[model samples]
Structure formats: structure tokens, C-alpha cells
Target: MNIEPTILDAVNKWLTPAFDAKTQEEVNELMTTAPKELEDSFYKDLEFGTGGMRGVMGVGDNRINKYTLGKNTQGLSNYLHEVFPNQEIKVVIAYDCRHNSDTLAKIVADVFSANGIKVYLFSELRPTPELSFALKHLKCQCGIVLTASHNPPEYNGYKVYWQDGGQIVPPEDAAIINAIEKLNYDQIKFAAQDNLIEYINTEIDNAFIKSSIENASFNTPQSAKDELEIVFTSLHGTSIKSIPAVLETAGYKNVHIVPEQAEPNGDFPTVKSPNPEEPEALTMALALAEKTNADIVVGTDPDCDRLGVAVRNNDGKMILLNGNQTMVLMTSFLLKEWKKAGKLNGKQFVGSTIVSTPMIMELASSYGVECKVGLTGFKWIAKMIKDFPELEFIGGGEESFGFMVGDAVRDKDAVAATLLICEVAAQAKAKGSSVYQELQQLYVENGFYKEYLVSLTKKGMEGLQEINQMMVDLRENPMKEINGQRVIMVEDYQSSTALNLLTQEVSDLTFPKSNVLIYYTEDGSKICARPSGTEPKIKFYISVNAAIENVSEITEAEAFLDQKIASIISEMQLK
Candidate 1:
């Protein structure tokens, strides 16, 4: 095959002495026989999004491999040098249990070392949140973790963090991207110099676990522990090692592990995807929970940052609580316990995303603690914590099954979440209330906040264009009513404007500009439309709330909420 000139040049460059021989042969084979695929692979560089770099694993400009990972690291290191020139620059690097993760971590360490930055590299696999916490605890200038998180087996990612221990945001994010964009084929440094890089091991691990236990909710009277039998799963990701240790160290006994899914593998052998938010991913754990007469089932993703739990409701059937429900349940339980222990000072507050369950806000307000809403990411929540130094952060969560308690880490920590949930379960046992019963009590106090998240994947260039067209159509012809409900207000975040459609008034939105549109109906229904930043998908978030007079009506309320969601989806043709 006659390859394109540009692709041929890229292949030749890969064959250079600076590049690995194995990578060179792979590129050569693709160039000689699969010219089209080669071009597609090397046509453009992988992008660093609002989070960080994520893509398919392969050797090319557009994929996640040693060379590309090196480039991203070099750029980040250069930016760190520029940002902290004349001062010591340090960074923490961690990786998950994915294929080549250890190698990638080593490569990143080499790049940081080559650039005159001190690197605190994890000696073994760790969760994404640990890296975030390490950034803060170690006082590093920046941090990186080689993890694809909940992505498919063939995918891997690199997340960049700032000194605040949150993922990089704003001017720094743009600056890092600018640095990454300037690299050419020959500019990235990939050579390894042994002394420049340092590998961190159990010292940090013990410290992190100690911190997890210190931050755990252990206020329950010691007598309550015997009644709690909790089942936990790691979903064949990174939590197989740490979650159990944290639970045992937190004084919770009788914890059962799902033996079938106990091992950590990048393929995520037992589940379709490592994401615990999906009920399908928790099938094995749920079954084990039922067999053991367990009170709850908790699972973490590959990187062990996000967590999902399935609880046996009053009906004795296992029901998976959505992300919103989980946060509401956890937050309400934590706050109640904190108050009981006399820890609810006036300065304590909670954080959640703008699209998370409104019940959190109501719960916080009723407790006389402020509830702050970030744009949509945990990093923003971390930023809020940094912004308000006077406020003591109780806990914060996103609806994606990610929650963080305590300020020990600036990001979500499933290990911390797991320990706390078990403690909460034990506390509930003392009160003769299961976690499910606590959820019902929360609804009795706060209004019922039902949420639905619908994601539509649109792949390739044409699919992206189609998604854009749908957004444009919606903007051009605004809807006045949906599913027989009148829309009272419309908020277009991309334009930073909110329209009072009823009064024909317009006002500027205070938040940063984003490609999101939100509609509020007269009947307390809220709908949000946002295009996914990292993937080929658009997500619709629906939140509907109503008063609940009694816990027995939860089933009818849930059914009513489901029907409402169905009508909205049908009216919007979102399927």
C-alpha cells in the first residue's frame, strides 16, 4: 500500500533510535499493510480534557501509549517548571491495576525527573483518590495518576492534579494544555536516569489508611457492631487490597468479600464495565449479599475512587440506589450521626454538584449547615473547600457514585467512603434502622428528590455533528411545555443566560460558561442537557421532587417518579 506522506513520516520517526524498537516494528507493519489505520491512529494527538488524557491503548499520536504519555508528562513538567521556577517542584504519581500501568507510571516518573522535578511515585497500584490526597499531604506542586478509571479494558488515562490536590482547572488547565500542544515528535524526553525518580511504597499506604480510619464515622456505641454484616466488592479493579484493610481497621468485623471478583485485572473479568453505578456491574455482589443475609453491598471501580452500594430495603429485596439516592442517604446519615456525637458545629458544611439531588441542599439547610453546589466535578467541590477556609467540610458527593468525606483528600475516596458507610450501617443498627430505613427517614424529613440520568452515545464525526445539530435545534426552537407540564424558566449555560419564559425576562447566569441547557417546569421538575466532555455522548439529567407523608408510600412515589421520567423522555424523544 502506498501510504500518505504525513503518515509515512510519522512511521519513520517512530523507527528512530529515540523510540523503542518494538513500537517501531508495530508502526512499520501498520504503515506497510494498514496505511489507513495508521493514518487514523497518528493523524492527531490525544487531547487532555477537563479531567485529563483518556483514549484507546496503542502506539500512535491519537492513542494512549508510552510515547504519548511521555509527551503529556513532559508538557506538564515544563508547565510546572514555569509555574514554580526558582522553587522546588514536586509531584506525586500513582497508577491503577491496568495493563502497562506500572510501566506508564515509571515512564511518567522518568519524565518528571528528567525535567528536574521531584516525583513521589507509588510503589504499587493505588486508587485515583489516593494520588489526590497524596498531592495535598505531600505538598506536591502537581500530581498524575495513570488510570482509565471506569473506562473499558483497552482504555487508559492520565489525570493531572494541582497543588490543591484536585484535578487541574482554569488558567492552569489551559496552560498545561498549551504546553502539551507545543510538543513535536523529537522534543519529548523519554530517557531513564535511575536516581532522578523515586518509588514510594507502604509508608504512604499506611499513612493513607490511617487517615481513612481517623476520618471514618465511628461514633456508634461499641455494642452495635455485631449486628452489621456488610458485603463489599471491588469489581475486579484496584480496591481489592485497600477496601478490606480500611474496613477491618475501622473496627467493623464480619465483612464478607465476593471471592469470585476479588482479583484486580484490567479486563474487569466479571463485569461488563467496572462502573459500580450500573446495577449490572453489581449483580454478583448483590447475589452474594442476599445469600449472606447482608445489610448492604458496596463496590468500587477499577481505580477505587467511585463507589456504588446496594441495600436490602424494608421489603428484603436488594435495590440499587442511584447516585443521587446514595449521596442523600449517606449525607443524611452522616449529618445525623455527627449531630448525635455533638460534632455538628456551626461551621460544618456539605458540598454537591449542581445536578445532584436537591434533597442534599434541603437536608443541609434543615440541619443549619450550608450546602454548596459546584459546576459538575469533584475538583470544583475541592476548590470550594479551599475557597471557604472558615467552613468545616462535613462531606461532598456527585451523582456518579463518587463521594468524599472529610478534607483528608481533595477528591473522592472510595476507601474512605466504604469505611464511613459501614460505620453508618453500624450506627443505624443501634437505632434499629437499616441503611434502607434511614433513607426512608430522610425522605420523611426532606422532600422526595427523584433523579434520572439518560446518556446517548453518538460516535465518529458524523455522530458529533448530529449531536451538535440536536443542541442547535433545541436552542432555536425553545420548548414551552414538556410532557403536559409548562416550562417556567430556561437556562442556557453555554450562553451564560437564563430566560424567564413566563415573564419574558432575561438575565445573565453567574456560573462559568458551559455547554449545558437546563429547564425548570412549573411542577418542580428540572431537566438538564449536557454533552459529554470526554466521550461521544450527550447526557440528560432529570430531577423531580414531591412531598412524602409516610415511608410506606415510597413504592408509589417511586412508581410515580418513574412514570414522570418516562413521559419526559418520550416527549423529548431522547431514546
Candidate 2:
């Protein structure tokens, strides 16, 4: 295979300047052994999507490398210079436990420093949210974290933030992408003054840990920590270094690490993807939990932005709770405790994504605290907090295991999430009730809401065509029934209209236009289909609800609901 003419130009440019000898060597090796791979790597540049740059880690225009990182930093620097020309600007940078994550951070730091911006670089790998928190804490002009979140080990990413500490959106996001598009190899500066870059590690780490612990409901003594036996695994990610320390500092004595996954290996040796939402990812932790008779097993992803937990149910089987279940448990626990402590001064509210379980809304309504539903992203939740100053944000999470407990961070903070989850477990134990028990009680009070998400990946240009066709099919031939129940209403978010099909009436959606579609059935079922904004996949979210009289009825009700949803999925040919 021959390198495309355009790709050869990029390769020649990289080999000549800025990039190092090792990168050139790697590129030459790929050119020799896998010319096609080299072409794929160099034919197109890694894009700055709604998030930021993310792709396989390698030495090419399409890959995540020093050049790409440097270019992105240069673009952001240029944008910041124009946005706040007269102001002395500071930027925060953090990395995770991924391959070349630290190196990428250095590249970003060098570019920012070269552009005359002060950089606060973390001395070691840390969670992503802390970068967001540090952005606001230091009042920096911008922030970036070198992480791919829960993506596979072969991947690395860069997430950009504005002065508000939230992910870039709308005009700013488009402006940044435009700047990046204007960049070339010669335009990115790499030389840096050592003094302009500050190394931050334990000092900030300690402060972040204390802040997270302080947000918890209670701090148990080491002696009483046995009341909650937590089996936690970092899954060869950054949390292995910080989570246990944070939990121990929060007075949890019985926190055990899955030995196979305790080390920070970018390979993520134990699991297929190292994502906690996947049951297979928790196999090792679950096995250890059963052997140790642990009360709960939790795992954080590679970057530690998202968290996954498995708890012992009433039937004595360990089951992983979906993202929705976790949010419901954590949100209700936080609000209930706040109300009990007389801290709920009527201005407190919680938020979640639109596709998240309606259980959160019901739970919030039960306590008289408002629950705001934004589109599917943690940044939107953060935006809500930034928009509403009078309303204190209690906590917000999505169904994908990402959560943020306080206004300390704009993105999901796994460090804070880990601490708060353990605290919730401890508080439940102190009440002589299990976390599972609390979930059951909440479900009884509010309707039993269950949700399932299916993600279908379409690769290459051909896959993109198929995805577009599928969306077209859904919009043109909307489902009239799901699981034998009639769909009463259809909400087309892209058109910003909600129509009562039977009544032939239409209304408006309060949210902005997005490419999401929702169908609500009379039998209390909601089905949502949307294409991912950042990835090459279209996701379907199915939510169903039922009534449960007691804990004993949970198993049967769950089974019935599962059957109902499975039938609908089959009918829709989602699989």
C-alpha cells in the first residue's frame, strides 16, 4: 500500500521538525510494516468534537500524539489570547493513568508555556474532575485533562474547558475547532520556560481528598468501618493510587483492592474494556467480594471520571447497579440526609440527563427538591449549576456511571463519587439497613423505574451512512406500539416538538434542538433513540416502570419488566 499524497505531506512535515526522533522511528516502522495503517493514521487529522481530541495513541495526524496535543494547545492558546488579550491567563492541566497520558500532558504544558500562559500541571496522574475543580479554584482561563475516560487502553484523549470549568459548547466549541483547523506544524510552539510551569501533586491531592470527605454525610472511625466492607478496583487506572487513600482518610478501614487490577497499567489487563458499567468488567471484583463476604464492590474506569458498583441484594447475590440505580441511591441518600440535618433550605436541587431514569424526578418531587433534566452529558448538569446560583446543586449523575456530587467540579469527579458512595453505604449500615434496602424503599415510594441502553457502533464512512438511514427510518416510520402497548406520544427533540399522535395536537420542548427522539407509551414506558455526539455510535434508551409492593416482589417484577423490554427490543430489531 502507498501512503496517500496528502498523508505523505503530513508525515514529511512531522519527520522534519517539532516531533522527536522516537516518533519518527515509530512512523517509519509503521510505514514499513503497515503502510495502510500509516495511511489511515495520517490521511485525516484527529478532530475536536463536542468534547476534544480523542483517538488511538500513535504517531500520525489522525492519532493522539505530541504534535496533535501541541496543536490543540496552540489553538486553545490562540483562542484564549484573543478572548482575554489584556488579562494574564492561567491554565490547569491534569493527566490520567493511560498510555502516554503524562507525556501528552507535558506536550500540552510546553505549548501553553510557549504561548506565554502560566500552567499548573499536576505532578502525577489524577482524576479528571479535579482538573475541573482546579480550574474554578485557581480561576484559570482554561483547563485541559489528558484522559480518554473509560475508553480502551489503546486510546488517549484531550478534554478542553472554558473559564467556567465546563466543557466547551456552542459558539466557543465551534470557535476552538476553527482555530485548530487553521493550525499547522509550524504554528505550534513547543519551547517553554521552566518557571512558567508549576508541578502540583500531593498538596492539591490532599486538599481535594479533604473536600470530598467533608462533603460526605459522616466519617466513621476505623473500628466501625467494618460495618461496611467495600471491595474496590481501579481496573489498572489512576484511582488505584488515590481512591483507597481517600476512603481510608474518610475513615473506611475495610476497603480492599482487587489485586489484579490495583496497579496502574495502561493495558487494563483484567477486563475487556475496564468500564464498570459492563458486568464482565466487574468479574474479578465480584469474585473477591463473594470470597471476602464484602458488602459492596466498586470499580472506577481508566481516568476515574466514572464509577461502577455492585451490591449484595436481598437474595444474597451480588448485582451491578446500572448508572440510573446508582444515581437514585446516591441522590436520595444525599438529599434525605441534608433534609434530616436541616440543611435543605428549599433552594437545593438536583439534576440528571434526560435519558436518565425518571426515578430521580420522582425521588426529588417526594422531597420537594426540584430535579432538572438536561440533555445527555455531565457538562449540561454543570451548566445548570452555573446558570442557577440561588439553587444549590445537591448532586447529578448520568446512566453511564459518571457522577458529580458538589459544585466543586464541572465534569464528573470519581474521587468525590468514590468518597460519597462509601459514605452513603456507611450511613445505610449505621441505620441497620443495607443500600439495597434503601433502593427498594425508594422504588416503593416512587414508581419502580428500570432503564436499559443499547449502543450500536458503526465504523468507517459506510457505517455512518447506515446510522443515518436508521435514524431516517425511525423518524419516518415511528413505532406505534411497544411490547403490545400503544405509544401515546412522540417527542422529536431535533424538531423541538412533542406530538400527541392520537389527539393530533403538538407542543414544544423546552430544551434546545438535538437529534434525539422519544416515544412514550400509555403503559409507562419511554423509548429514546439518539446518535452519539462524540462517538461513532447510535444509542437507544428504553425505560419501563412498574409497581412493587415489597422487596419480596422485586425479583418477579424485575423479571417481568425485563421480558417486556426484551420483547420490545426484539420487535424493534435493535440487536
Candidate 3:
């Protein structure tokens, strides 16, 4: 195999004395025996996206390695010093169960401490949300969590959180990127100042668990909590550290953990992938639920920021609730509780992404709470809270199996979300209803909405080209209709414009510029095509809804939506 000139240039640069012997040896090995691998690794640098930097672990600027992460930390350090000049800059760090996360986290800590910054490092693996809370709880300027979320086992990542307990946004993201781009591998500081670095564990954990309970607990009666039998699986990830304890403190006692997948293993041996969004990832949890006749089943990704839930339907079979379904259920319950407490006076709101179900609007409108739609990242939702401090952020979530109960932990938090769902389930069970029944009633009152997501992964340099071409093709040749429905509107986020296909009218969209395209049908169907910013995949989201007369017509409503989606998918040739 022949390596390209650009790859060879990056390869030769890595062979310098600035790189350690171990890294140099691995690079030489790839050069001689694995040319293709070498090309893949050095083709380009790993860039941060909406969720931050995530990629396979290896020895390249393009991969998640000590050098790349160190560069990021060093750049962050410089940026912090610039932004918070002459102040004592402090930061916190945490890691998940991914391979070498602890080591990578320590490397980052060393970089910060060497730059005369105070560092608070977690002594053990912890969920991602705790890092966000810890940064704020400790009054630090920034935080970092080493995790790849729910990607494959070979993947690891670094996510940065700002002072607001949210991921960096806008000018910050751009400035940090500029700092990192200006530096070379030799400029990163690797020395650790023991006096400046402090190891932390229980202090942050206790505070986070307490805060989670305080935000998520709705005062479900103790009797209801005991009656709500639950099964949970961490998918061999990090949630096992906090979720059970949070549930216990929230008055939930009948919780069962899937023992086989309870241990924090980086390999994620029990499942093909650690993502809870896939039903197969929750197979063991479902089995345990069936064995124990559990009322509800819940699971989380490796980082524990997103959760998947299953509940017994009216027919007595446990069915997994998609992200949109859970979003609607959780938001509705929160709104209802707020109304009962007289917290809703047009001074509160909920959040959803453009790709999420429009039923959120219907649900929020009925309660007189505004629903804010943004780009497809929890970070954007977090931005909403910071941008609108005068109004209360009751709750918010995207269709990607992530939700945040409050702004305490600005990003997606599964630990708190799990507890919130348990409260919902227990409250429903006490009222002679279940999650399934509640959802049916919601459909009967509101409209019946179903959502589907298709993610097509494109790996390596060639694959990136293919994915880019796909988006370009869609934009250059816009679609006028799908499933025999007239296209009423087209919202292109990149252009920041909404084109009304019917009247040829155009209006401006007040959203961040991103490569996303959405088509609105005359019948209220929403079809969105977006390229994922974190992973190398293009996602197509389909949302279709129909009004239901009553709960008895739910089956027919679902069938009609299903047929509509299938026809839409077929017409688009997505499959």
C-alpha cells in the first residue's frame, strides 16, 4: 500500500524526539507493516464537534491519544489563562470505564497542573454528569470528562465543560480551537505539579447524588416507591457507580441491577455496543425484568448521560420506549406536577431539538409552557438555560435518548433522568395506571406521534467524502415531496433560512449554523437529514403524527403512522 504525501508528512513529524519512544515505535510499526492503518490514523486531526472530541484510540493526530488530548488541554489552559487573566484558574477532571480513561485523565491533569492551574481529579471512574456538577460545585473555571459516550469499545473521548456546567459553545469553542491549532506537539506541557493537583472522590459524589435527588424527587409516596419494582443495567459502563445509590436515596428500594453487566468493564463484553438506544443493548436487562416480573426496565450508555426505558404494556409485554416517547412522557409529567404546584405562570419552558417529535409543542402548548427547539445537541439545550435565566427551564431532551431534569447538570444526565422516570412509574402505578397507559391517554388527548431514526456510519477518509457528497446532493437537489404529501416547507440550518415550497416565500431561521436539512409535509410530517457532529454518521429522522379519537383507536393510529413512515422511507430510498 502506498501512503499519501500528506499522511507521510504527518508520519515523519511524529517520528521526532518530541514523541516518546513507545509512540515512535508504534508509528514505525504501522509504517512498515500496516500502511493503510498508518494512512487512516494520520490523514487528519480529530476535531471537536457539538459533543467534543471522540474517535478511536491510537497514535495519531487524528486519533484520541496522549498527544492530541494533551494538545487540547494545553490549548484549554492557554485559553483559560487568557480569559481569566491573573486569577487562580482551577479545573476538575473525571473518567469513565473506557480503556486508558484513567491514564488519559491523569495526563490531562498533569498538563493543567504543569500550567500552574489547580486540578481536581476523580480518584475512580464516575459518570459524566458528576464532572459537570463538580466543576460548578468546586467553583472551578472548567471541567473535562474522558468518555466516548456509547460508541464502540475501541472508542474514547474528551468532553469539555465550562463554568455554567455546560459544554463550551460559540466564541469559546472557536477560541479554543484556534489555540490548539496554533500549537505543535512539542509545545504541550506534561509535567505534573503534585502540590497543585488534588485527588477527589466522595466529596463530589455525595454532593452530586444529593443534588440529583433534590432535583428529580417529586415526593412519590414511599408505598408507591416500594411497589415499583425496577431492573437496571449499566451495559458494563460507569452508571453502576451512582444510579443505584441515587434511586435508593430517592425512596426507591425495589431496584435490581443486572449482575452479569454490573461490573465496570471497558470492553463492554455483554453487548455488541454499549449504546442503550438499541434494544439489543438492553437484552440482558429485559431478561432480568421478565425473570423478576419487574414493572419497569432501564439502562444507560457507558457514560451514563443517556438512558433507555422499557415498561409493561397493556398486553403484559415489556416494550422499550424510544427517546421521543420518553421525552414526551417525562416532560408531560414535569409540567403536570409544576401546574399542580402553581409553578406554571408563563415564566417556565421545556426544550426539544428540531429532530424531535412535534408532539412536544402540542404538549407544552396545552400547559402554557413554551417549547424551545434548537440544534441536535444537549449543549445547545444547555445554552438555552444560560441564555434565558429569567425563565425556568423545567426540562429538556432530544430524540437521542438523553434528557436533563434541571440545569444543575447542564448536559444530558441519565443518573437524574433514571430517578425521574422511577418517580413517574411509581406515581402512575399508585394511580392504577402504568407508563403504557399514561402514554395512551396522552395520545388520546394530544396527537399520536411516532419517530424513527436511521444512522448510516461512514468511516475513514473515503467514507467522509461519501457522507459529505450525500449531504451536498440533498441540498443541491431539494426534495419537493415524500409519501405523496406536498412539501410545505424546507428549513436549511446551514443557510439559516426556511423556504416555503408552496408559496415560494422565505423566512430566516434563528438557529446556529449547522449542516442540517428538514422537510415539512402538508400533513405535519417532519423529515430531517443531518450529519452527526460527534461520530462519522449521517442520520435521517422521521416524525409522523395523527390525531386519535380515543385510546381504543391507538392501534389503528399506530398502524397508519407506521404505513406512512414506511412509504416515506421507501419514497426517499433511505433503506
Candidate 4:
């Protein structure tokens, strides 16, 4: 067997006395029997991306193991101390249903406590958004949640949040990375200071649920609540308790849970993958909904952050709505309800990502509200809320089935989103319509916008080089046209510049620098290309739109837009 010198050095470090016996044994076995796997595992130290550090669970510097997590927590602890030097530092920690999530949460709490920082740790598994809410509700300086979001069972992650309850962004993220690099494996403080740790559960759950209910806009009649049949599946994740509790508390009587997927299990035994974005993940829920004649079917990812929904179409057949459709429906509903309540005082705004549909901008504009477009993550949207303190943030979402309601929770919250979606359906019912019909009505008022996302996964070290090269090639050779449509403008987020191809004018962009490129066509079409920050994948977001005068034109408009997207993909030769 052959191995790189650097890889061999990393392997030897793991075999030393600093590592646990179990980890050392695994390393020894891998070196003797599985050199390739060992090399991949130890080739590089895991770096924190926009969603924090995440990797496959294994025994190596690159994996999400005890040593790596300990080092990250220690680094965060040190950074928090430096940032809040004169105050008593406190942090909140929560875990999901992933393997060793609870164990990692304890280790993190221990490390924080060992550093003389107060730790508020959940007694059991909880949704990711609750961690964000707890961070603000408890007035903590920093927070950590052990989750890989919607990743596969073999993966786990660590996410760091600031006091604003959003994932760490900008200078703070870079500074924390610098601090982490300066620490060695042996330098991690894992010892426990029992006195500094506090276990919380019911109080936080009650508070979160109360806040969610209070923030919901209830325009549906009592009959809508009584007649709405909802089928919810948590996909064996942490929302098993909170989601149902909220629905029942909100007076929804016909809510049914997919018994097979209700329990919180990290293995995610029922579905091929726990991610609701994949149609297969919702297969069981859809079947149950059909059997029960349900009006709406909702499923959440493992951490309960992203939501996927299914509704009966005009044909009365159950069909899953894409993330963009869900976002459009939710945003339109919230904006209209706000206006009806006379809350549209021009001091309110909504947010969306560059990859999201532009229809949200039109919807907000119709209500005299501002729509802000940020980079791809919910953290960026949360930052928008903090940056514009004068404006009331109504709600916002992305193309990835993640939505944030109100300003209580800074991250994309599936729990609150689920409740609000149900409310939308009920309100639609009260108007002698369905959620699907409401979506069509939205299109009739605002032009029809269709969005599609294609992700190409490139794995391992060699794959990383391929992904980087793809981005470089796209940036160096800008596309003048796509699918016979003239590209009017090209926005390079990395360079923070927008170039008008027709006028040959280059202007600076106000948003932060990121490795993303967006092309706008003379026709109403947008194409964005970006590499995933948390995974080894590159994603292309294509949005094309046309005017819809009535509901009859939806099918034709969608088909036309679909063909346009296909032509663009073919021209780019993306496979």
C-alpha cells in the first residue's frame, strides 16, 4: 500500500497517546487494511464553511470526531472570551437525532464549562431553530448545535451562532477560524466543570412554542381549522415532539403523524435519506395522506430546519411543490396578511437569496414593502434583519425549502414554517380554495416564476479540484448569452461587481464578496452558479418567468419555462 507523507504523518499523530484508545485502534486497523480510506480521512483538517464544520463521522482530523469537535469548541471559547472580555461569557448548546449528537453536545458543554463559561445544554434532542431561539432568549454570547442538517446518516456537524441567533458570519467566522488553526489537538480543554453546566428542556420548549404561536398570522375561520386534514412526518428527526405540540395547541384537530417516522432515530431507518427535498423521502407520508384523504402533507428534514410540502393539485392528485413554490406561497400569504392588518407602513421588509425566485420582489413591492436579496444561506437573511434594525422583517425563504417566520428565530425554521403553512392552507380553504389554488392566484396577480436547482456532487480531494476549476472556468469566460437569450448583465459576487454587457459598464455590488456568479437575460430569466460551502458539490439555480393572465395559463407557462431551463442547461453542457 502507498500513502502520501503528509497523510502518514497525520495517521501517526492519531496513534499517539493524545488520542483515545478506540480512535487509535481504528487508525491502526485502517493503516494496515484500508490505506486509501485512512488517507482520505486524514488528508486535511476539516474547515468551517458558511454552515460551520461538517464531515463524515470517523477517526481523523478531517472527520467529525471528539478531537476535532473539542478543538473547535476550545477555539470558539477562546474567541468568545476575547470578544466579550469584560462580561460573563455564556453559551447555549443543542443536539439533533444524529449519531453521537448528544455525546458531542455534552463534550462541547464540558469544554465551554472548563473554560469558565456558563453552558446551557438541552436535556434531549431538539430542533436546530430552538438552539437559535435559546441563544437569544437566554441572552447568551454564543451558541453551538450538533447537527449536519439534512446530510446522510454517516455525517454529523457543528454549527456556531452569534448572540443574534444566526450562524456566525463575516469577520467573526474568519476570526474564529484563525483561532481554531492556532490550537493543537492536545491544547483542547475537555475537562468538565460540572457547576457551570445547566440542563434545560420544558422551559425553553414552552417559550419557543409560545413565541411561534404569537408570531403566526391567523386569518382562517374556525371551520378551516376544524376541517383541515394535515399529515406530518418528521423523518425520524428531532421535531417529533415540538411540531405536533404546536399544531395541537393551535387548534388543528385532524393532524396525523406518520407513525413509522415519528420516533427520533439517528439511523433514519424508514427513508432512503432523511432529507425531505428528495421525493422518495416523502413517499410514505404521501401514501398515508392519500389513504386518509388529507388536504396537505408536510415533512421536515432531520434537524427540522428545511420543510418540504405536498398539496392536491387542481386534478385532486397529490403533488409535491418545489422549494421555490413553497417560498412564494408563504411569502405572498404573509405579505397580504400584513397588509390586511394595516401593518404595511413601509417600515417592513422581506428577504430572499439570489438563487430564489424574483417573484418575491414583485409580491413585496405590491404591498409597498422592500425585498432584500442576499447570498445563498439563511444566515445571510438573518444578518439582513440585524443590519436593518429600523425595518420590521416580515418573513423570508430560499429555494431549498428553508423559511424563517418573523424575527424570533434567526435561522430557517421548519417548525414555525410548518405551522404557518398550515395556516395558509386553512385561509385558502376559508376562501373556497386550496393551497394549490392560492398559489395559482398568486401567479395570476404577479407574473409566473419557475425555479429549478441542479446540484453536481464531486467527492474526495480530486473532486474538490474539479469543483473549483468549474467555478474558475465560468468566471474567466463569462457567458454572453444563454439559450438564444441575450445576457444583459453579469454579477460576479466574488469580485463584487456587476457588468452590463450591452453598455459595457461595470459597477460595484453592495453585498459581501462570495464565489457566486449570476447572469440576467434580456428576457426575464436568471441563472446563478455557486459551489456548496458545506459539501463537495456545485449547484446551478435557474429561474425563468412569464406573465400569467389567468389560472388556465399556468400549465402552459410552466412548460414553456421548463423548456427554457433545459435549453440553458444544454447550452452550458452541464451534466
Q: Report the number of the highest-TM-score candidate.
A: 3
Candidate RMSDs in Å, in order, are 2.3, 2.6, 0.8, 1.2
Across 447-523, the per-residue lDDT of candidate 2 in tens digits comes to 78889999999965566689989989888998888889999999998899998988979999988677899999999
C-alpha local distance difference test of each model: 0.84, 0.85, 0.93, 0.92
Clashing pairs in 4: none
What digit string (tens of lDDT, one per residue) describes model 4 on residues 1-575? 78999888988998888888999999999988888888789999998876777899999988998899999999999999999998999999999999999998999999999999999999999999999999999999999999998888999999999999999999899999999999988898889999999999999999999988877746567788998999999999998868999998888889989999998998999998898899999999999999999999999998999999999999999999999899999998888888888888989999999889999999888888999999889999999998999999999999999999999999999999999999999888777899999999899998999888889999998998999999898888989888998999999999999999999999999988998999999997999999998888999998999998999998989899889989988898878
Q: What is the lDDT of residue 554 in candidate 2?
A: 80
Q: State TM-scores per candidate.
A: 0.95, 0.93, 0.99, 0.98
> Model 1, which residues run further than 4 Å from truth?
1-21, 31-44, 341-346
Which candidate's lDDT is highest?
A: 3
Query: What is the C-alpha lDDT profile of model 1 across 1-575, one tens digit per residue?
Result: 56667766766777887777889898888777777678667766678764577878888887899889888888888888887889989889999989989988998898888887888888889888778878888889899999888888988899988998888877788888889888865677776666767788787878888998888756665577777888999888888768888877777787899998888888888999889977899999888987899988899999998899888778788888888887887788778768978988788999998778878899999899899887777887888888899889999998988899888888888998888888777877787778888888888889888999999999655667888998998788989998898999999988989999989999998876778888999998999888776666888899987789999888899899889999999999999
After aligning candidate 3 to the native by TM-score, how far in Å is the CA of 357 from where it should be? 1.0
Candidates sorted on TM-score, descending: 3, 4, 1, 2
Per-residue lDDT over 1-575 for candidate 3, one digit per residue giving the tens place of the 0 to 100 score: 87888889999999999899999999999999988889889999999987999999999988999999999999999999999999999999999999999999999999999999999999999999999999899999999999999989889999999999999999799999999999999999998998999999997899999999999989798999999999999999889999999998888889999999999999999999999899999999999999999999999999999999999999999999999999999999999999999889999989999999899999999998899988989989999999999999999999999999988999999999999999999999999999999999999888999999988889888989999998898888888878888989999999999999989999999987999999999998999999888898989999999998899999888999999999988898887
Candidate 4 lands at a TM-score of 0.98
Ranking 1 against 3 by lDDT, winner: 3
Model 2: how far residue 394 lies from native, Å: 0.6
Q: Which window of ten consecutive residues has the lowest lDDT sum in model 3?
A: 1-10
Q: Which stretches of candidate 2 lie over 4 Å from their true place?
A: 1-39, 42-44, 49-51, 219-224
Model 3: lDDT equals: 0.93
